[model samples]
Target: MNAPPEDDLSLGQPNVPATYFKDQRVTCEKDLYKSLPPLINGKAGYQSLLPDHTLVDTSNHADPNSEKGAKIRPDLGHYEHGVVSEEHPTMLDLIILAYEVKKARKEDIVNDTMKCTKPLPHDDCQAPYENTCQTSTITRGQLANYATQICRRQHRTHFYMVFIFHPFIRFIRWDRAGAIVTKRINYVEDCTPLVRFLYLFGRLDRAGKGFDPTVQPASQAEAEEAKKYLKRWEPKLERTVFKMDVPAANGKMRQFLVWGSLADPESPLGRTTRGYPAVEVIDGVVSAKPVFLKEQWRSVAVRPEVETLKELNEHGVLHVPTLLCGGDLPGQETKTHEISIGNWRVGHKRIDKRIHTRFVVAEVGQPLENFPSSKVMLGAIYNAFQGHDQAYNKCKIWHRDISGGNILILDNNKGLLSDWDLAREEADLDNGARAHERTGTWPFMSVGLLQQPNKQHTTRDDLESFFWVILYYGLHYLPHTHRDSLDHMMKEIFDQYDFAERDGMARGGNNKDALVRRGRYLGSRRSQQFSFIGCQPLTEFLFDCLDLLGKWDFRYDPTIQSWEEDGYIPASHAEMEPLWRQALQSPLWPVADRAVDQVRLSKRLDFIVRGERPERKGSKRSDPHDSIQDDEDDDDECSPRKRRKTCHGSEAAHL
Candidate 1:
């Protein structure tokens, strides 16, 4: 992650300016003719065979009656008036006949014939029959033509020819019998290895069952409601799709050629249990639902946008993609032009009717297996944070879901943060709706996210989820067991890990010792360990991340008491300089290293507060909401035994 060597030829020079930090645009069509060389033509002429078996062009303008002219003529008196005659000829006739034969041989020479096979060397093989020997002595050009002729004779059966034009050229046979073209395309560019990995893993469309309108037929009332909602949201959705392209990794063709709609029962998106009838296209058109559910939450609480904004402000920081469009209404068209590669599917097969509503395509540079474990995979996670951080700061957007599935690794090995279905713009950190339901993958949910009235997701929660993702990559499993049932998982997370109490302990303040007790238990040596468990460094990193969440601290300006507090302190700014430098250097390393630094700084700040002179007068009054109070800790807690254990070692590992 260090700056690439200055003299590296492959990297060349950085083209983007420092001030214009945005997604880089790649010309999708540039890879079409990368490897083919120019065509060239050879000489055109004929040759004659002499009496000595040497071949030459024998033509002379001055020797009209001589042997050379006789060879070129069609008739002769001794050889039937310059036409070489085989019977009743004199010595002059014999010479003219031989010359004419040589001239006839010369007229038969071809310039571009392919030699199918070389004659066996005199020492390598027994002498062949005269006729066979003559046939074997063919040119390379003659050979090629002969082989092509043989192929046409034997294999000219029916088959469709597919021509793909791109990074590479390929001719494929579609139907061997019918001779119909099924698909012809050029090599794709801009696709990264991660995208290819996901494709090989399987297209997202195959994740679940086909749509069943018979089972979940829309009620008359619901259908009416949907129609009304669509009318209000359609224009905004169109504008969003037209404004930006979904970042994709496919480079073969700039525009996608979609054949159907997500709303169609037969379409990939409509067949999912939690399906959205929206279609998203990278470079072409996909017609379906306009907005999908913002989160996987079970209930409707606060507006989805409010939660999206809050998360972006706190967790996304700066790398959120602009929200082209989002909402619950169906039947609106949403399009994205940004090309990316990733898999998208909706619903768990076990619980809901499998609906394959989500679709994602990305450009991963090479095959997925070729990616070095730590460099490409882990690097992607790190870069996502950088981009997410940028978007949060610059565009005031937050990405509530920052999972492996949502992150796309581009062909250039850079991670692109995508899936803005749950993104939102924010003006301030503290001003947003309170969502009361849990959403996002269960394995990465923050401890607080598991509690009831699940609407309290924050940047800290996102950080905690990010920790889970890193753990997933390193350990290949969640830190704790998932419940047997989704309901159980939700309950365990919402009720057991009290965010408020853990927050106090994180700040180095006293709380119901239960919070610390839980942390020790989870991180303790006595806990059941799995084979995929990460090494100490990784575990320690996870612990540090948890500590940061407990402390509610951001890496930037750690002196700020709360995210809402706004002031630029020169001293705090100086302290942040090194952190920023570190971030720039390792743009793609997980935030673990930096998260640890933030935790350490938070602890130091707490120490300084405790060590301050009590006699100092007129210190600014601490905001009541910002103050950590030991008395306010909740005593109500859920028993761990009530939770069903779902982690069955590495069986659930996904790359």
Candidate 2:
């Protein structure tokens, strides 16, 4: 059969002859370039540029498949003539447009020579890319950026080809709307010829049909099936209700709501959004080998918890939901793409960033907007703290961003520390100080991290964030008649914690007072919890936690008779554990004694509020000795001097 016209991009639609893809006598790399049809505009001459921006190859002489048109012609594609060259005089202009060209360092000759001496054992050279010799590959984001640069420079959509290797190519159509699609094509017998012709013609097959990159799951029925499968996997997921498509960091996302199980249906999980369950369906092409991707980091940080929680729950030491599920999305080809710039990797590429789509089922709980607390709050947060300690010390994963939303209170009054997206391995920490971007929720960040944004974050910072979480919620959410005072205190706290702005201006100015220590009242607010004074032990716990924060805030600059004056003792988990235990043991601590039915505790508190004597079975009064104290008489109970003497003495003894 006669070959389809060279300009026809739809060669695949017809029954292409087997001879069409038969190998011809290839002379040099230039012959391969020429054999391919002109892709940009109507003119020909395509060249592959190396990392150094040098023309690696541009010879265009067709042999057999593209033997008809073999001359090097001028490029009149979407990009203006000369825009394709790395040294195109407008290169600096491109960089200004944010198309950064990050060059990889040259390989070490001695090490590379030593490596190639013999056939490397499969185990020895398992990660050949890890060797110093490999040139750093660019990412799709980088391609998108460069395409954007071309578009901005020319004021029009530009069709660009990013060649990772001969058989691997990314077809990019960039414009004001962004990349139409970053299509990765792998060379195969029949398809290779068609891909070559399509690129040469500057048109993807079905060109008039607008390119839609938004991933539509093969079927909503299949997605629904996936949800049902997850519901079966974890019986806690009741039913998914609302779903909306959203942009994903790594893939297309479909965010859906599920009806989740209460932490403890029998016990009262205080202040929960019971009907709302968090479910996200991440759907995208599976685009890399599992071994060579940063998805492993997420696996390391998130997974193992399913089994770890099982083990911890069995032992009765740490308790949390076996919440995370969904491995690789099923029913997709395991295709691999080149390492590209995405959320995980920005400037440099170390490993492949796989685009994954899966159903992420997790517990959704109350937000901290106007959250109220009970005695169970103490125990719940304590257990949640223990959960963090377990994840850090036992699992070797640190929850870097522990803010209000990251934790949830279950129906049973159990607190679950969640949202491990910012969690990192202890090993990755050796890479040096963290960037300011990873400073978690700005309000919950530690003073040191807030003040010196580039400083290395430690577990101490996370602990401090947790401290702020408790204080912020406790101060703002406590049901007190002093609404005016609470509002003022809330404004004060928000001012101190809002690191992004100051007195109204962005903190971009070098204002020394903007530092956390200088801006806020540290120990002053503890005295303001007038209503909570009757809960003496709880008050003491709060003071002690604040004391630790105060010491940590000025850890380096010690006072004349400071806690660390005689011996420099930095805050550690060991010191905090006793405080958590003390908080748990408080009579006012919620869940000190849990009821199968949570309403009983509410009734007990209600009866106590009414100043009535208990009259019914199981109508228990909590801490009966404290009944006479009212908010009016509670001032003396919460006196800073008294709390300092008692709580400080206990903390010192523990130290």
Candidate 3:
């Protein structure tokens, strides 16, 4: 058979051999023979390497008949011939083994080192962790000793920060209206840690709200539930209420209404729109001035004038009622009448009288006869001063308008210091430069305060007014002759002492006549005797109080120290001892008894130390029968002991 031509193959056709060709003889070619396809010696062409048929081996490879095959031996270390020997574990194996050894050794080394060396200072030292400790125990003890000094320094820095940055912060959020409504809950479990802590500690109730001091305890389950809720929302409702700045619609006017009745209903003097005269509550009860009205006189003149009166009242440090609400009196009117109770106005009416344009209604308080005894009054005053000091520390400005009319008597025989219309921010203390004239009631106004129209009013002026009020309360008369108006009083004070002089009266030369005249007026028979005249102990107490004020320099001395240091004593030593002793003496003592006894004891001590002994009219041996006569006269006076008995017994209970 002949192979097909390449071209024929390409065309996909078979080619016929040329052996039977009719027109041509066959030509023998050696090359052509050599080119013929070669035959296979062993197998056919294009055969697969796999055998076609299987060969049966009678001797199995595992049979003993086969030399190459032997019974399978369980030789663990058998070596095969011609096969590459598995060389005794390569360098990698030795390296891995070495690594294992090194790892074990490293662990051992670590363990040994740990054992050899001491534990870390934090662990070994039983004290606080040294690494994170801020101070050693010794250092902390030293710091404790100087805590006050450190606090003072820190406080100075804090004050600087507050003064400099607070205004800016305030401006940023000044317009923000605080939360309007709030709900109080005892405690909630979902509350934050702080809320939970507060609730757990009884600081907050079960609803996670601030705990009311008067509230009674709740059941355990309710408390637990409250804790759970407290965690959900930290109720700061009470705090928010206090922080909320309730907007005052009118510019500066605030109105108030005190609800209570004065002891003397006939004398409507102390009646205020918000207080006693308008409304009658039980005596000695905690009465509230529910209504409030405040008026900010728009005109600069009116405001300044009113502010002057307010400042004078403040200066005298008189107790005034809080201002609740006020505005321009109704009608296009220039005249109005407002009743002032204590310092607050209860009601305001537009009166027909031109001179008395504004009528403010104030609640009437107790009569002078029902007023707190001298000791109680003194204590209240002291408390007021302390409050003033606290206000100063807070950088709050207080313009106390102290005056005879502003003072009031409470059923409890205590005085409440009220009113804040004239009060300015501490930052406004230097605003005196804006005013053209003195801005306070004349009699209480300091000399400098009167002369320097723009001179900043300092706390010193307030102290001077306090002195005047104290004198008035003791003597039942003004230090100077009564002037018809505020202006007249101002003029008199200025004329008597040249305020322009740096030294005030001291530098201008002592006006002894003025002092003596004032003294005489107070001592004169024409002066009205207060109801407590027979109270010799009270009289002596008043004298001692006067002495404390007299020792101080009332003028605006630029070099004066803080009020606490130079002007007032923080602790009333004489008063405290007796009260403390009394408190310890009777644990089950009635509140009224305690209060009265404390007052009486304090007064008695005061009298013994300062009061003048009564003169014996006739030199006669003391008679037992005469003792009752002496007692009658003594009882007329304000005796601390009598006061105690009255207070502890039915007197307080009756109210």
Best by TM-score: 2
Residue 185's lDDT within candidate 2 is 42
Cα lDDT listed for each candidate? 0.29, 0.37, 0.27
- The weakest ten consecutive residues by lDDT in model 2 span 646-655
Candidate 2 contains a number of clashing pairs equal to 16
Q: What is candidate 1's lDDT per residue for 216-323, written digit by digit as tens?
A: 223344344444433322321111111111222242212111111111011011111121222233423332334332211111222344345335545535433333
Candidate 1 residue-wise lDDT at 28: 36
- The Cα error of candidate 1 at residue 653, in Å, is 15
lDDT (tens digit, per residue) of candidate 2 on 1-655? 1234666644333333434324634444344444342322232233321111222222221112111111112111223244445333233122111211111123111112212222212223222322233342334333433442232222111233333223333343332212322333443234544435443433332122112232222345544544453342232212223332333336434444322222211100101111223344445222111100001111112233234443444554453444334333322211112322232211121222222223233343333321245456565667668888887676566667666655656546577665454555566676642323333554455666555545566878778777767665555444433333454554445334323343221121122123233433333334433434345566567667766655565543535356555553566777788988877666654422222222334446666788876546421111100100011112112111111011011001100
| Per-residue accuracy of model 3 over 390-471 as CA lDDT, tens digit each | 4444434554443322343455555544333334454554564333322343344444444444455566555555445444
Candidate 1 residue runs with Cα over 4 Å from true position:
1-255, 258-371, 427-437, 477-517, 520-540, 553-655
Can you give the TM-score per candidate against the true fold? 0.31, 0.43, 0.30
Compare candidates 2 and 3 on TM-score and give the better one.
2
